[model samples]
Target: MSGIIQLDNSDCSYIKANVSNSHNDAVAFEMKFAKDITIAQLKSKLEILTGGSASTMKVELYKGDTFVTALSNNDAKLGFYVNCDGLRLHVIDTFASFGFDSESVEKFELTNDQYEQRGDSVRNFLKQNRLGKYNDEEMQQMEAKRREHAEQMQKRAESCVLGARCQVTVAGNPTRRGTIMYNGPLEGKTGIFIGVQYDEPLGKNNGSVGGKSYFVCPPNYGGFVSPLSVEVGDFPPENFDLDDEL
Candidate 1:
């Protein structure tokens, strides 16, 4: 019969663990576990901290040399593996080694416009997956900075020349290309509005916008847009056919 060996209170210590993905990106975590902690218990803690499954982790203990033993038995207590304070454990993610096509890991960069396209989804994901280490004040400050940047971008777009080619993305519609005919507040409007002469008749009215006439244009060829929805860039003028021009 095998006898169980009890560890004193002083024997419990914090283990310095590093979990590395296939790309060699590593996150450090301080794990406090007693000598009686099982391999499964340790991997579970690592899973929560690293945002990965414990089943895919390959655990290795650092005692002194590279020949140190690996922790492969889920039922074995940590005491049966090593005996050292400040012991280090390396957890390699086998799931992340399968390449980009696998659902294991995803990496990509987004431009400013690309980010705005899926901003709502990105915000929700960030809020849901944020680490507990970030304080409330820190999160608020981050949000404030993001709002400020967006306001600055809108201001820059509003500074575009009146005759410049532009594009505006309105809710419930795809991006519409046009020319900035006017930029300012209109009667009965409290904020600045951008008057656009669309390439196609994808607009609500002629140059007269918001129940007020700002410029002359064919019917259903002009519209007013919000400065925030506008993007100024080089776009070729639309060749108007004589039939449609009427």
Candidate 2:
């Protein structure tokens, strides 16, 4: 019975599925599948809802401790075992039961509101299971990293003297060569800044960032960068020549 079934209708059959993970955490949800879908296709859909691999998931039709035949073949059609509508399919995830990999299974491309709703469910589950220790440890580590970054920024700000030759390396952007025109906080800004007058016109504004000017320069020839990203160095401009002095 591990082949396609010729059903009378082409419409998808919506059925309630009881998906249980390795830890016995169960979630009931409605799933739609074409009547002639193979066992492999049904297993794939259950994997999305339960994190169960198609190779390891066990499918069964049961009712109140009643023993029923398990769906063992991945090539069989749904209509082979699912005789009528509203049939309950219990999907057991063997991969999760052994506690080997416990990564969260979530859908991607979710909106902010959808993420917030899912986050609430996760928070409730964590609270009920007392699984907040791992999250707390991760937060502490992140806070430590923030403090380390602040200390580095303070050192860079103190070392950045006006007219100092510097190179700014913004993440994912090309390195920029410039001179430190100013080295202090701008008006209406929270953190210290390094106003760089670039050797080329690869800047956003004339020594300004976000509409606040810290120093004057030609338009599109200067920009403000974070002191943390500014590398104060003895390296002069690439075109600077000792032969000119000679």
Please name the candidate that would achieve the greatest lDDT relative to the true structure.
Answer: 2
Candidate 1 residues 1-246, lDDT tens each? 001111223445433232333323322333456657899988887677655578878777642223245789999887666443333566767543334555555657666667646747433344455522123564475346546645764576557679989987764467789899987767744346778888888888898854679877788888886676678888776565788675
lDDT for residue 40 in candidate 2, whole number 0-100:
91
Q: Where is model 1 poorest over a 10-residue stretch in terms of lDDT?
A: 1-10
Model 2 vs. true fold: TM: 0.44
Which residue pairs in candidate 1 collide? none
Clash number by candidate, in order: 0, 1
> Each model's TM-score?
0.37, 0.44
